[model samples]
Target: MSTSGSKDMSRRHVLGALAALPTLPILPVLFGASVARADDAPPPLPSWNDGPTKQAILDFIHATTDPSSKDFVPAEERIATFDQDGTLWVEQPIYTQIIYCLARVPVLAKANPHLAKVEPFRTVLTGDFEKIAKLSLRDFETIAVATLTGMDVEAFAAEVKAWIAEARDHRWKKLYTELTYQPMQEVLAFFRANGFKTFIVTGGGQDFVRVYSQRVYGIPPEQVVGSALGTKFGYDKAGRPFLTKEPKLLLNDDNAGKPEGIHLEIGRRPHAAFGNSTGDRQMLEYAKAGDGARLSMIVLHDDASREYAYGPARGLPDTRVGRFPQELDDEAKKGGWFIISMKDDWKRIFAFE
Candidate 1:
C-alpha cells in the first residue's frame, strides 16, 4: 500500500446543527420518497460517545464540505489516509500479519527440512506464543520475508484469503475481522457518506491486506498502500503470464517512508490523516503540512479493560508491538493532534461488544 492529521476543529468548523421544529410534520414526497424524521435518522457516529472528539470529527467534515465555509474543499480533493494496525484495528499482543507469517513456518520447514533446525524457524515451530513474542525483530523479519515470498501473486493472495477467513484471535475466540473497532468503522462510513475517498496506508504486507480490505473495511484493493515484496514477471510453460513474488523488499511504508509512499502512489496530499504510533508521526505531520483545513489525529490505546492498552505515552504500559512513546505523545500535544481516548470516547469497543 502507498502509505500516507489534524486534531482539533475550532469554532470555524463547529457548524450549527439543523434542528427541526416540534410542530413540523414528516411528509412523504412526490415520487413516494419520504422525509426522514430527525429522531429516526441514524446517528452519524453511533459508537462514539457525545464528546469533543466526536464533535471534532463532524465539524471537520462539515467545514470542508460546506460551500459557505472558507475551508470548503471540492469533493474530489477530500482524501483521507489511515494507518491500519493500531489506528484502524487492534495491534496489541501480536499483529495479525506476524501471526500469519509464523503460522506458515511449519509448512515452509516441511518443504525445506533444514529450515526446521534454524533458530527463528525452530522457535516459531515450538508453537508457544509467549516464546514467539520474545523473538527479536530480526527473527520476525526472517520469518516474514520467507513466508511472504516464493509464490505467484495470485496464489499468494489466495492463500492469505483462505487463512484470514479461518484465523481467530485466541483472546476473544473471534475471527480477526470481528475484532475491528466499531468506532473506526463508523468513521470510515461517515467519511464516505460525506464524499471523501478513504485509503488504507498500512505498514503490514500490501498483498495480505488487499485480500480482505474491501470485504472487511470497504476499502478497495487499489486504494491500499503498504510495505511490499518485490516481484518479477515471466511466463509459464504454456505461455501463461504471471508475476512471482521475490524475497527483496520494495517500499517500507512506515515513519518517513509513509509520506514517500503516499506521494508515489496517491500523488496528492491528503486533507486528513489518522494513526496510533510513532511510526505514524511523519504521516500526521505530512497531512498537517497540506493547505487548507486539515486534521491529524492519533488513537491513543489507553483502555486496557476494553482493549489492550500499552503506550509508554502517559505511562499506561510499554509494549514492543504498537508502541506509543511519550515523545510522540508530547509532540502530538504541541502539534495540535487529537489523542483519541478509547475508554472515554467509545461507547463500545468492538461491534461484538
Candidate 2:
C-alpha cells in the first residue's frame, strides 16, 4: 500500500478502537458551585465555570478520592499527565523550541561562520518564514541537532532557561511564560489538591522542558517526560562526570510515544490525562484504559480571537505545528472524552492583561 494509504488505515483503526470505548455519563453534581469558602471567594478551579465540562472533572475527582466510593483510587495511584506545547502554552505560529533554534542561529553563525550559508540556518537568518514553514520534519530535526547538541546538560539547560526568560510571544508581546492558560493552571492545581500527581509528557526535548517546568507549571523536572537526544557520559581532567548532549535521537515522546513515555517514566497508568492535539491521542487512550475511573480530556482551541485557531474543523485552518485533526474530535465524542472548548469553557486564556 502507499504511505498515505497506510496512514489513513492506521487513523481509521485508531478511531474505530476509540469509538468502541464506553463514554462515562456526566454525574449530577453541582460541585463547582458548592466549593465557595465562607468569605464567598472562588473555588480552586475558579476559571472553570459551573458547566458540564467542569462538573465532569469534579465528579471524577469526588468519585475517585472518596473512601466510600467504588471508584476510590489510592493517592499514590492517582497520576495525571498533560501535554505541554499546545495544551499548556501557546504553540501557534511555530513551536517554542523552533523559535529558540531560530534565535540561536545568529550566535552560532557568528562563531562557526560556515553555518551562515547553510540551508536551514541561511533561510532562518533571512527571516523567510514561508521557506521555514515549508521545511520537512527532517529539516527541523537537522536544526534541532545543530542548536541543541554538543553542550553538557547543565549548560544546555542554562541556555534554555535564559532563552525562555527573554522570549516573547509575537502576538501578545508578553513573555511566553506569561501566555499560559489561566484555566489550565487552575486545572493543574486542582488535580494536585485532589491527590493526583501531575506530569508533563511533551514532544519537546526533556532537557528543554525541565528548565522551566517547575517554575511555569508547578511540575517538577522529575515529573516531566519528553523527547530526547542521546547523551554521552564524560569526565573532565578533574574527573568530574557530566552528560553531554548528542545530536542523535534517544526517544521521541509524541503520538504513540506518549504512552510509552508514561509507562517507562511513571511506571503506572494515569487516572487522568489532558492534551489538545492529535499527538496526544495515545496518551489519552492510555489514561482512559486504566482499570478504574479515568478522565481523559482534550483542549479545543476554538477561540480564534483570544488565541489562534487551527484545526481540521469547520472554518479552521489546517495547521502543521499543532494540528488537531477532526478524527480526534470524532473519537473524543465517541469515546466520551471531555472536549474543553476554549471559546465556551475558558473564562480567561492568559494571565496577562
Candidate 3:
C-alpha cells in the first residue's frame, strides 16, 4: 500500500476503536474548573484531539518517564522550557503586557503631568485606540519603561498585582490571566506530574511576569525567566532597603536571547521546548540540539472562530504581534518539530470555551 493510504487506514482504525469505547464516568481533569470523578481518572490532554500531535506528547512522556523504557531520562534532567505570549494564552491584537502598559500610561501621565505632552504618550493620552493600537513595539517599550519602572520593586509589583486583579481582556470580559489556554495548562500539569521541571521563558519583563506566575500558571516566580531591566539597590526614606526599577537593559529574553537565558538562568539545556512565533525559533532549536528523546512543538494560531487567528505560516492573516512567519513554519517542518494546529489539534482553546 502507498504511504498516504496506509496512514488513512491507520487513522480509520484509531477512530473505529474510539467509536467502540463506552462513555464512562470520568474523573475530573479541568484547568481550574473541576467536578468530582466517579471511577476512572480522566486522560491527560482532554482538550486536545486524539491525533498525531497529542500522540507525540503521549509517546514522548511514556518513553522518557517509564522506568523500563530505554529512553528514560533521569528525573532531575527533565527540563521543559515554554515561551509565554501566544504559546500559553492569547497574544493577538497586542500582548497582554502591552495592554497593561497602555492602561498604565494615562495613570502615569496623571501622576507625572509632564509626560502627557510626549509623542506616543500624547497619542496614548488622547484615548484614540486606533492610533494607540498602531503604536510600534519600540514605542510600547518606552511607554512600559515609563509606567512600570522608576518605582521600587515592591511598588512596581504591587501596582501590577492590583492591575492584574482588576484588569479584564476587552474582548472576553474575563481577567487576562483567566485567558490562558486550557490545553497548554494541561500540558504544564502533565509535565510536572511526570517529573519534568517546567520553566517559563518569555520575551516579557521578568519581574512583571513573576508577580502573577505562581497564581496564574502554578509555576513559581523563581522558575520564570524573561527579558529583564536593571534595578538599583538603595534605601527608602525610613532607612529601609529597597530595589528600584532602573532604566537599564539586562537581558532580552527572546529569539536568540532565549537560548542564552536558558543557559544562564537554567544552567542546562531543556529536554523539551514549546513556542508559537519567530521569536521562539532559537529556543526550539536549542531544545532539539539536546541528546536523547527531545521534543519541540509550536502552537500555530490558525483558529479564528474560537479565538483570534493570525499566522502568516499557512496563509492565515499576517500580524505584527506574535507573528508565525512562513520561513519559521518551514524551519519547524524541516527541523522535525511538531506544528500544533490550533484549529485542528485543539478541541477547545480557552477554559471558558
lDDT of each: 0.84, 0.83, 0.85
Write model 1 residue lDDT over 1-353, tens digit each, in one string.
00001212222132122133232343234212222332234657889898888877877887787777799899888999999999888897878998899888888898899998889999989898889888888988888778898799999999899889998987899999888999999888888877889998888878899999999999999889898888999999999999999988889999988888898888888988999998888999999887778889999998988898899988889988888999998998898788899999999999997
Q: Pick the candidate with the highest TM-score.
A: 1
Which regions of candidate 3 are displaced past 4 Å?
Answer: 1-39, 136-138
What shift in Å separates residue 197 of candidate 3 from its native position after superposition? 0.9
Model 1, position 50, has a per-residue lDDT of 84
Best by lDDT: 3
Off by over 4 Å in 2: 1-41
- Model 2: weakest 10-residue lDDT segment is 30-39
Q: What are the root-mean-square deviations of the candidates from the true structure over C-alphas?
A: 5.0, 12.3, 7.4
TM-scores for all predictions: 0.90, 0.87, 0.88
Clashes of 3: 0
lDDT of 3 by residue, 1-353 (tens): 01122233444575467557775444123211321221123567889998888888887887787667788899988999999899998887788888888899888887889998887899998889899888887897789778778989999899999999999887899999988999999999888877899999999988989999999898999999999888999987899999998888889999899999999899999989999999999999999988888899999988899887888877899988899999999999899899999999999998887
> What pairs collide in candidate 1?
1-224, 1-225, 1-226, 2-225, 5-273, 5-295, 5-296, 6-295, 6-296, 7-338
Q: What is candidate 2's lDDT per residue for 1-353, written digit by digit as tens?
A: 01112223444575567457665343214322322221143355667666889888877877787777799898888899999988999999888888998888888999999997888788878887888888888888778888899989999899889889998977888888888898899888878877889999999988998999999999999999999888999998899999999988778899999999888899988889999998999999888988878999999888899997888765578987787888888899888899998888888888774
lDDT of 3 at 303: 85
